[model samples]
Target chain A: MHFGPHLLLAALEGLVTSAVLALTALGLSLVFGVMRVVNVAHGEFFMLGAVLAWAITTAIGGHPALGFLAALVIAPLIVGAIALVAERLVLRRLNYNPEATIVATIGMLYIIQQLALTIYGPEARPVEPPFSYRILLPWFGYSGYKLSVIATSALLLIATWLVLTRTKIGLIMRATQYDSETAQAFGIPVGRVYGGVFALGAMLAAIAAALIVPISQAHYLMGQDPLLLSFIVVIIGGLGSLRGTVVAAVLIGLSDGIISMFFSPTLAKIIATLLVAMVLVFRPQGLFGTASR
Target chain B: MTDKNGFFDLSKSTLTRRTALKGLAAGAGLGLAPGFVRYSQAQSSAPIKIGFQSHRTGIGAAYGRWYEKTTAAAVKAINAAGGINGRQVEVIIEDDGTDPGRGAEVVGKFATQHKTDIVFGTLFSHVVIGSAPAAGENKMPYFVVSEGHHVASTKLNRYVFQPGITDVKSQIESMAPWIAANAGKKVTQIFPDFAFGYDHRDYLPPALKAQGADVIAQIAIPPTESSFTKFFPQIPAETEVIYHVMVGPAVLTFVKELGEFYGPNRPQLFGFIDSLEATDINSPGLEFLDGSHFWEGSPRYAQADDSVAQKAYRTAVGIDDNGAAVGDPKDVSTAAHMFGCWETLYVVKKAMEDAGYKGPEDRAKLVEATEALTEFAEGPEHPQGPKTFNGKIHQCFGIQNISKVEGGKLKVVHKTKIEDGLYEAEGDYTTQAL
Candidate 1:
């Protein structure tokens, strides 16, 4: 194949996948920084956002913006409410057992996926891409929308960083993650803090689902890949550290992009997982994790 | 578009109005013309029930929708032709969601409570395997439209039949030799870790072994897996052909991923038939697979001109009626499915007419007549295809091989018309023989 077509396609594929990877890791970072529980079902939340976006968007004449708006606005509110209820009912009773919470969230994942299948059907509902614009770069072609994913996700990432570091709610959310008991001792309503954090996490997932799904499309099973990748990102970047997650997200994204260009998709993932495992074993708390943690 | 005789010419007789009215008066109670009355009967008492289970939201939705569209069109056509021995046919469709348990439940409802005349359309292999037993137990004739080899393997049920080349073997049989003959005679395979992808990849190497072709390596990642670039370095360097068994979006992702991973600097790539999709040819990563060959038994969307029967099928189903090749003109899944259902119904109609269906109560007699059919000779539904039922196997025979596009049309590069029993298969359940 000619280099023009080859490089163009590689760039497009990398852009699509990297966008999803960054957004998914962003959610994990937000959740770990606040609730201190790895929301295993974050991918499911992403999936819900996609399905919700797809349902609304497809029903209303194939508009991605509607789905994006629906997902961005409604998904967090709904899944946040569910997270609240889940917190009250389940997480509250777990006595803060990290392992138990992890297992419970895993259960939540299957339950949600099965429920979705029950109601929506198991087949993939491919959402029409929001727009069709191919920019030809001197014998190479790239979808305008694909480039948009990167641009949009980058904006979201920057906005999230700004909110977490610059806003009042962001300060409280971080205080809760640093020390829940002390945050409560210092007059922070830990319950409300948890709710806000969960909502923020859900919102990140929804936005990612809404934005990235235009390329990968949406399906029930799509949640798993990003979920797994997000976990790797969190582990590599350092749990509960937004800055670290961002660094690792970019590193992993770039690594995957470049490696995939030279290898198969399956091989690229295998290599990424391998690298993450090695890093985890060698650097227990992750690249940026505090030694105390 | 034609009668049982396979002739579309209505030029044989031109009668005067007086003569036509006289003939109408002579056969006054025959219940034939002004077909509107018959369709109105479709909304009548008990809703002439036929059950269909399909993947409404699963991976098979594309194929499932086509099946539904074609079936709906055939029902309308049947009603126009004075439906099912004068009782208009009404199909009650259920979404199986592409899950076996869901499929089983839908079949249970159709065979028991809904009590349909026949049940048709299950898109997944495991779903068919799980639900076929129930259809056989209840003696309800089940028509499946899946590509799983397992259904053909069991051959246990007397009531279940899925027409065409029932296995993925046909593809391997066609490709292994061809890839060996070209592409440096060394092949590496990559597929999804799940049942759908694993089966084809697993089935192929053995098939290649039987064909005296050497398989370099086989790599499988999880189904619906997002990336494959990690494993690229591990691929045996001697490998030349890459058989891709990935399907749907995952396949799209894999191809795009592979395109990026393996450039012109890498070995030449090939793929399993399912991965050769025309719709995704415009995918940014598709340039990598442009010249890659695929072997499949399914009718290609970009292939040869529409056969006479296919043209009639297009007209019967409100499809464009333009051309019938895989990956070109349009998604041919709709046309392909319409042909299968249309042909199945045509065979049932001929059988019922031969056995003299007085009403829905004659279900037993209808099954017997269906069992008794020896062959179908170039009928309006089959056109150039055949419909032969071995009373022993309860299977109908015929299939079109997969094709690739050349100059905006798909053409089958392999496969020859074979004898009827060449693709014969039996059901997978015990049945009370009619």
Candidate 2:
């Protein structure tokens, strides 16, 4: 078919969406690692990244490459700075009450959405994909840009895993995750680690948003799905478990992709939601999640 | 009217460039100077602050962009012609993001902060419903290129006027007679599972029944649908025609999947105005739609009564009457938006001059003048027929009818005039048929 390339490129959107969702889940898992706070507003950070991506990109002549990367840098940094303030002000006060953290983040989500509407207004504007050139595979037409996304996500994931497992900072982060009080008593700067973890989680989400901006047009409220998808992934993979996140993300992505291809995209959502509900009822801790005490 | 549209009768007298000259001349001398001043002033002093709430990034992005681009083009043309009473129509366009709540907020900001004379756009029914009240409260003329029942509801105020009609039920009204004329058997109905899907669901049953046409089937998915694969197989072998109205990415996805599933025995497709969709007209599934029809406007087919120049514009733009442009396969939105923007801006220019509004300011007065506006030249809806928004609900009272696709684009096939109050709806299924 003459439109074979177009058709393939469209299908590639599913894969890229998966890769981006994996990144978002990575943020969720990392945040779970330290504070044990289910940051409901993690997707808000992703949304901020998308918003900033558009802002920075449009400011820079809509050159998506520089724009997205700039958002990548700026989004995480801004979110991290905000996280720092929230920690000093809000989360620090709620240390004894985990539910408070959840409530706070949920509140923050609405605030952020409203703020975005104020800043950008509600409209879907296509962000120029940082690259030009559709990669037309011989068998069908797959987008080169989507392939680029898959590659970039692969690199980021590897880099993240190495940082968490091989470095001294990684040990500190893991120790802090197990019990913040225990790690602090051992003379580790648990507070600083917490800050860093927050920054790191936010940074991953920001990166995901930057990558997603090109394919999914930037809008004020695009973060909702990624956030939901990430929550599902992190739990299914096991909380604070990087390997679990990776596997779950890919699995969910593939399921979503194939379902969308064969059935309806809406029904695929219903199926995924149902799957999550069933998993929670039976496994509770998730496929890879450690048994919660 | 079914076989030959009354609105596009080739024998009808058409206003030519020659007749338009006197108006154009008066427009140029008076129109040129103030418009030039206003336009240049907007570019130079104020950035031409025109406010827009377009759905550039959401489900309605397809509809919103056409409103944005066409309005932008019209502003460009009006500014080129002279500037509105002379300041360039500086536009502050915002993407409505396809959410009604967001739309309402954007409308508020445009009215209060941006202080735009008028706000144009938003094709989604929900978005229009959410946004229009703000404009009406502010008494700002909200010109929307949208189709929503609320546009004609009692809630409607003079501040809102649809340059295009609101309710899409009429598209069926215009097209049904033709199906009655052309088809050998009955029609099936299929649509998405949402509000629009339900709206059409309610609209077509009686429309077909009114024509004494048999209803073969009515297929509607749940509100939480992802695809139409499950429903595709149910197209009864006895069903000869299908009346459809699915939109957005779903349009391409649904049709392609259906065509793939249908193979050889696909139903003869009948549609709401959506069949004239610039997005779906020539996609992979278009072969399945070769003989399918939609009741629509004259942007695709030449209105037999239109000026030669209208046909020339269609040919020159590589589009028929549907306001669709060719070149990029997915560029229907751009062309549709550009045309709407052009027409909108031009209409504003005419209204502004007529109202004697001035400069890069006077937003309130400009809006009033726009609300005061009543008439515009009718043009053929490509892939359909001629349409004009000439009635009180701000809908096109006499100008709407049926349209079909010809030459890979939409053209006028039929037309009928229906005033807002004349239709039946106490939830009663009785209405005069075509």
Q: DockQ values for all predictions?
A: 0.07, 0.04
The complex in candidate 2 yields a DockQ of 0.04
- Could you give candidate 2's per-residue lDDT for residues A125-176 as a string of tens digits? 4456666444434533233566788989989999998988999998888888
If candidate 2 were superposed on the true structure by all CA atoms, what would the RMSD be? 16.5
Q: Write the per-residue lDDT of candidate 1 for residues A209-286, one digit (tens) a residue.
A: 877665565577778778888989888988877777877877777666656665655676788899788888899677
Instruction: Please give each candidate's TM-score.
Output: 0.65, 0.57
How accurate locally is residue A116 in candidate 2, as Cα lDDT from 0 to 100?
A: 77
Q: What's the C-alpha lDDT at position A159 in model 1?
A: 89
CA lDDT of each prediction against the hidden true structure:
0.65, 0.64
Q: How well does model 1 score by local distance difference test?
A: 0.65
What digit string (tens of lDDT, one per residue) describes model 2 on residues B162-201?
Answer: 6544356655555566676676358777876665676677
Ten-residue stretch with the least lDDT total in model 2 chain B: B425-434
